[model samples]
Target: MKKNIVVTGGTGRFGNHLKSISTKHKLFFPTKNQFNILNFNSMLKYFNKTKPDIVIHLAGFSRPMELHEKDINKSINLNIIGTANVTMACSQKNIKLIYFSTNYVYPGINGNYNEDDPLKPFNNYAWSKLGGECSVKLYKNSLILRVCMTEKPFIHKKAFANVKTSFMYHDEVAKILFKLLNKQGIINIGGKAQYIYNFAKKENKKVKKIYQNKNMKIKVPFDSTINIKKLQKIVKVKF
Candidate 1:
């Protein structure tokens, strides 16, 4: 059956791709100006007006991992507190909340982390995302996607040969998103596990291969690939 849905943070990379898709359900992509997540009343006002049955919370601070380290307050306010406000609004309106999290929430080493696996965020960025997860987990009608997705065309000119990941494109994940709208609790959403160099090489042969070094400022995860068995079973599509 068709349902009314609202997507927050429609301006983001994934959210932009999501707007291009055609689905049976009606979707509303409200800009932050229209539905500011930090303002709980704004979310409630939008929900009350639209009467949506589902709210995809995609508004959060991300990108430039350095920002999280430098501006911890903004990270906490946007990703953590903003998400909590969204959850509260969703709960009051009885809307199914689908949150966008990250695969970085899992311990980097020892890949194949599942939904039930123990979490240990790699950096301050991941920690902020996990903080949002905590609030969404409280709501009974919520689905958390610990997604491993990135911009298409392989943004980086260099790929980490030593680091492994399950990086899928934003559009790829958007294609399968509608199928999992009604799912509750958390789901590990990603692609097949592969070395970063291997994944990027397929798209750009000129991409340079680099290994994680101790001198590097950023904390590189040796392996942060997530298991997508549950997602495959539901979508009936092999990754």
Candidate 2:
């Protein structure tokens, strides 16, 4: 019998891709309205009924990075508190949990940060994700993916030419996820580190090049590329 896998943010950009590739495992993606992460009882009830072997917790606030800065409460409630609720519910039921994290958790000024490197988040989004990471660590049966994924074809008209990162398409990340579903602990999931504009130009030649200044309103990570050598050896391919 196929094991059941439940994705918390089934309607999210990344979750949608996870749902598409879930063949070996039966996938269950519940919408935010139906499965509110803020409500612990709601998640507990569902966990009791489905009893999923693995829960990919994807529901969280992201994008428009300014939103996290302006609304501290929302960021705390969704990414931090919501993750706590999920962690508590999963811990009680003894279910495996996979937490989606970001490379921004590391200092963006440097490159090639390993999974064990110290974290110095440059923005609120990273802080919120780190908040979630703290909870996942408390639970022994959990995995945290410090993902460096971007939308395919680059969504920006002007990309930062000077900035470096390990960016992967959402589809690519989704394809690689299942191969490591059973693995526990933290893993850096991304492609080789390179200029952001160069990575985007491959799929979008017309994308303009621009530089971001530190004085800007939004705090951006300059070079948050992660070291995925361990992951490469496990997957046996460049991602």
Candidate 3:
């Protein structure tokens, strides 16, 4: 059956990819004005009108990592309060909520974190997403995806040599997402564990590798790769 699906953040990098991959489902990609997630009343009205069976929540504070650190209020409002409003509306309407979280939520020191690992955010951005997870956990019909996805073909000319992460491209993650739409609860979505340079080299052999020193000022995780055995068992994919 082609169930109705609403994808928030339709214009975002990942959300846009979901639109292309979710052609089999009855998809509605609404702009913020059409369904302002920040406004509880607006969210309620939209849910009542659309009456979708599933809501893919990709809308949240991302990019310019500095934003989360500088404007803590906005990060809390968008990721936490916004998520609470959406989950509340979905619960009332009996709609399934699929949240897009980050792998940074896990303490980066531990390389392979499972679904049961305690959350220790590496930065304010991760903390905000974890805040959203808190609200979704309150709703029984919610699925939280702790994703470590990135752009394909090494979007950048230079890659970090020392940073290790489970980086899958936006398109690759999009396909897996469609396959696991029906499943619920927490799922860590990503690719194999490897250094940033090695992961990028797969797509672009010519990609330059620049090593980041331990004393570097950048506040990034050392090794935040997740254990994807459960994801593989469920989705039956090698990703």
- The local lDDT score (0 to 100) that residue 90 gets in candidate 1 is 90
- Candidate 2: regions farther than 4 A off: 214-218
Residue 168 CA error for candidate 1 (Å)? Answer: 0.9
lDDT of each: 0.91, 0.88, 0.88
lDDT of 2: 0.88
Best by lDDT: 1
Better of 1 and 3 by TM-score: 1
The alpha-carbon deviation from the true structure for residue 86 of candidate 2, after best TM-score superposition, in angstroms, is 0.5
Q: How many Å off is the CA of 194 in candidate 1? A: 0.4
Model 3: lowest-lDDT 10 consecutive positions: 15-24
lDDT, candidate 1, 1-239, per-residue tens: 99999999988888889889999999999988899999888888888899999999899899888899999999999999999999999998889999999999999889999999999999999999999999999998999999998787999999999889998888889998999998998998888899999998988999999888857765678999889898888986555
Which predicted model would earn the best TM-score? 1
Ranking by TM-score: 1, 3, 2
Q: Write one digit per residue (lDDT tens) for candidate 3, span 1-239.
A: 67788888888888878777746788888899988888878777777778899999999888889889999998998899999989998999999999999999999986899999988999999999999999999999989999999977678898888888999899988888877778889999998998999999988999998887787676678899999988999776563
TM-score per candidate? 0.97, 0.95, 0.96
